[model samples]
Target: MFKAVINVNYKPSVLDPQAEAIHKALGRLGDDNIATVMVGKYFELTLNAPTIEAANDQVERICDQLLANVNMETYRFTVTPLQGATA
Candidate 1:
């Protein structure tokens, strides 16, 4: 078994409305030091596969094909096996 951690975030150049709103709220709260904020998604999945290499490949494909939009969003992931687990 393996654990996959996926993180998705918007590009820096793109404006994030949610971040903007939070920034504004922070300013109202007397926190003007903040300049910008970005919102993103995180996914943690436990998968059962034969090998870590193959499982990682499959997870990457899933992220590219479905979890994230290649054109607008960027995604990165890490895979770790459970204790005493082979592959």
Candidate 2:
């Protein structure tokens, strides 16, 4: 078994409205050090496959198809075997 951890975030060049709002709110609260915030998505996927390579391939397909918006969002992930589990 394999577990995939996926994270998707906005492109740096794009402006984040939610972050700007929070930054302004922090300023009002006298927290000027708060520069910005980026909102993102996190996902954990479990797959039963013969090998890590196969599982990773499946994970990539899923991310490209659904988890990430290929135009605006970028995603990264890691694949690791489940601890103490039989294959």
Candidate 3:
């Protein structure tokens, strides 16, 4: 077993309305330390595969196919090996 984390975010060129709203709210609360905020998606998944390479492959496939919108969003992920598991 392996632990994977998938992070999806809007392309840098795109605008994020959610993040903008949060920024505005923070300013209202007198928090001006933040300069920019961006909204993104986070996913945690557990995958069963024989090796780290296989686990990474599976995560990449899912992210490319479904988790992220290639036209507007970009994604990154990390995989960690798990202990005491059998496939």
Candidate 4:
């Protein structure tokens, strides 16, 4: 088995309203010095592929097909073997 940790976030050119709000709130709470913040999605996927290459391929497909919006979002992922499981 393989474990995939995926992160999906907006392109740097896009505005992140949620992040901006959080940053402002933090400042109001007396925690200053924050220049910016960004929101994103994190996913943990478990797969039972035969090899690391196969697992990576499946995750790439998943990210491109559903996990990320190609027009506005970018994504990266890491694949690692789960302890005691064979892939």
Best by TM-score: 4
The model with the greater TM-score, 2 or 4, is 4
lDDT of 4 by residue, 1-87 (tens): 999999999999988899889999999999899888889999999999999999999999999999999898999999999999955
How does each model score on lDDT? Answer: 0.89, 0.89, 0.93, 0.95
**TM-score of candidate 2 versus the correct structure, residues matched by position:** 0.89
Model 2: lDDT of residue 58: 93
For model 3, residues 2-87, the per-residue Cα lDDT tens digits are 99999999999999999999999999999989999988999999998899999999999999999999999999999998777774
Winning candidate number (lDDT) = 4
RMSD to the true structure for each prediction, in A, is: 1.4, 1.3, 1.1, 0.8
Runs with alpha carbons beyond 4 Å of true place in candidate 4: none
Model 1, position 71: C-alpha lDDT score:
81
RMSD of 3: 1.1
Per-residue lDDT tens digits for candidate 2, residues 37-56, read 78889999988988999998
Which portions of model 1 show Cα errors greater than 4 Å? 84-87
In candidate 3, position 65 carries an lDDT of 93
| Candidate 2 wrongly placed segments (more than 4 Å) | none
